[model samples]
Target: MSRGFKKFSKNSYKFFLLIYKTYKLTKKFHEFDRIFKKLYNLLNFVVFSVFLGVGYGKYCIK
Candidate 1:
């Protein structure tokens, strides 16, 4: 019985460690995803503004 309990405890500890590591990795992935999305939005906005400026300039010239 003591040996069985020790084995069980060791397995449980390993399982908990795996879960903790997975949680940390997923958290980091979410943070990176958020940063990437923000950067993508900013890039889109800059490109749109540049296009608008060119269009307006062309209209003014005409």
Candidate 2:
């Protein structure tokens, strides 16, 4: 009985550890996703402004 109880406890501990690690990984992924989105938006804005400037210059030249 004691051995069985020990085995059960060990399994539960391992299960909980796996869950905790998965949670941490998900949290880190979400943070990285947010940062990537922000950088993507900034890049899009820069590209848009550059294109607008080029278009305006061409229009003026023409």
Candidate 1 regions exceeding 4 Å error are 1-28
Q: Quickly count the clashes in candidate 1.
A: 0
Candidate 2 Cα deviation (angstroms), residue 58? 0.8
lDDT of each: 0.66, 0.66
| Model 1, span 1-62: residue lDDT tens | 44765577578657755755675577667775666557656855775687678778888988
lDDT of 2 by residue, 6-35 (tens): 577578657755755675577667776666
Candidate 1, residue 15: lDDT = 72
Q: Which residue runs of candidate 2 sit more than 4 Å off their true CA positions?
A: 1-28
TM-score of each prediction: 0.52, 0.52
